[model samples]
Target: MDNILMKNEKFLEKQRTYTYTGYNLTIHPHKTPEVYIDFFEFILKEKFFLSTGFRTYHLALHDLNYLDVNNKLTGLYGSLVRYENLLPSQFIDLNTGKTPEDLKLNIASNIKYKPTFFHFIFFPENHKIIFELENERSTISYNVVLQFFKKILDSDKFKVKFTSGEVHTLTSFKRVNSILKNKKLKHIEFLVSRPNPDIFGDLVDETISEYLEDQKAKNMTLTLTAQDGKYLDLNDNTEKLGVAAAENGEVKAVIENSNNRTEEISTKKFPLNHPQIFGKSVTIRNRLLMAAEKLLPKNKISR
Candidate 1:
């Protein structure tokens, strides 16, 4: 055999993580369809400049493209940029070892700026919108973005309120409690695993502990129902245990009440994210649009 030496090497590719938070947007009832279209069109060309103390910030929309074919428009895609005009006080002379104050800098003009970006896709037919923030390194938050949106709508004299709420990662217990708050819980079904002496601390009752040791059961399915709208009052410890299991995704629960409504509590944090390769061929906008396309359902739009 020839002396052929092959060396194995490990390579790590640079990847960007993208997190898109889902939202439901409802146009104000008073605003007509024409008015809504006009408002969005106006914002496409508008640049919002706001100042906080000495720092001036800019918010603007860019890359306004429509998913239209043969004069039928269905969706819109764009990016929101939030940047800050760096004040003279933020600069320092590296070679001269002098700060802005030492150099007697009194001008209000700024020459440098830092920016944060958020990409969004909107379906006008269904009022479904998705937003992906820049990166985790950016200090800007969704609340700040929401404020800018509201400010622009107000400044543009859009009368109707634009309300947006996120679809969050919520626990089943939280959802159940929220929907049935102050209402009678008529039925409930949940699964509980056999108690582990090492894990269940005070949660495992004396009877359950003995039962687990003797029977060696793996799990149990409990279904409780009240008669004629009566409430099933669960003990505090049992409820706590169920809730803990639900948070961990170990419990499957179904509860029905007279006051049950289709709703979920929204949060600002995006709990889901995906990693992708960042390279020359794939731009940030392209990556965002690609991610947004996967979230749309075929029959989501009514028309």
Candidate 2:
């Protein structure tokens, strides 16, 4: 009994009970924790909440039920087709060029139809669905999925287009802002995957303009193997981005990852971007080049 107890009498005197009101809880984002703004609705509902989302650590909160003391919680995980009713229409109407008033551009339109990597954070008290989308670039799909939220939710605010077909600013921006801040938590994966093909290329365009604007954005480099008709006009876009970056002392030189098959780099400038050519994937143009009777110098300047 030498391992016995020495008790402080003060420890026996008090018991504290913690109450988790709908207001008391919040949907903590995966990465950025500093942002803890409460949404208009309470997330804790008595019944089960529903979702069809990419699994992540933050999502555990829903299944676990706010780390309950009694060890009981509720959630509903359904198939992609199952949640059609939950999804908003006009959500993926970017290509249509015609967006409905109630429906925001859908996130699904990007990168073809793949498994969606998003979640719906439920606020039980307010009966609101805090749709949390992960903004990522580590993979092609990550960026594409984020397109949904990015297009609809502006920085720390919901850029809601009104019902009367007229855009209004009646709602308090701050309340919505908190929701955005919490949603934009840390990058889910180690690095955001580059979007595929069309989507991937667009990201290169966005990266220079958005995140790297403040740096010495000189001599930026782009790497990709483009087929003859792949419509690679990044040179023009990069030049524009470079100039803007320069105004802020960023992005000087540019290099394309063309990697050698046919397209050649033609440029000479310190703050220059040279498209480094890479061999393109197997394509009709590539087959013809392979079948050529006489070898044409790649520097033939076809374009």
- Please name the candidate that would achieve the greatest lDDT relative to the true structure: 1
User: Which pairs clash in the backbone of model 1?
Assistant: none
Model 2 global lDDT (CA atoms, 0 to 1): 0.24
- C-alpha local distance difference test of each model: 0.48, 0.24
User: Poorest 10 consecutive residues of model 2 by lDDT?
Assistant: 162-171
Question: All candidates' TM-scores?
Answer: 0.47, 0.19
lDDT digits (tens) for residues 1-303 of candidate 1 = 133322111123345666564343334322233434454676764544554222477666655766663432366777776667655666778877666565554545333256666777766554445677545455344445556555664553444334321122213233434322324555555544443232233444334435544775544555656676466566655555444333222333334534664222221222223333454346655766676565543311011
RMSD values for the candidates in order, in angstroms, are 17.2, 24.2
Please give the range of 10 consecutive residues that has the lowest summed lDDT in model 1: 1-10
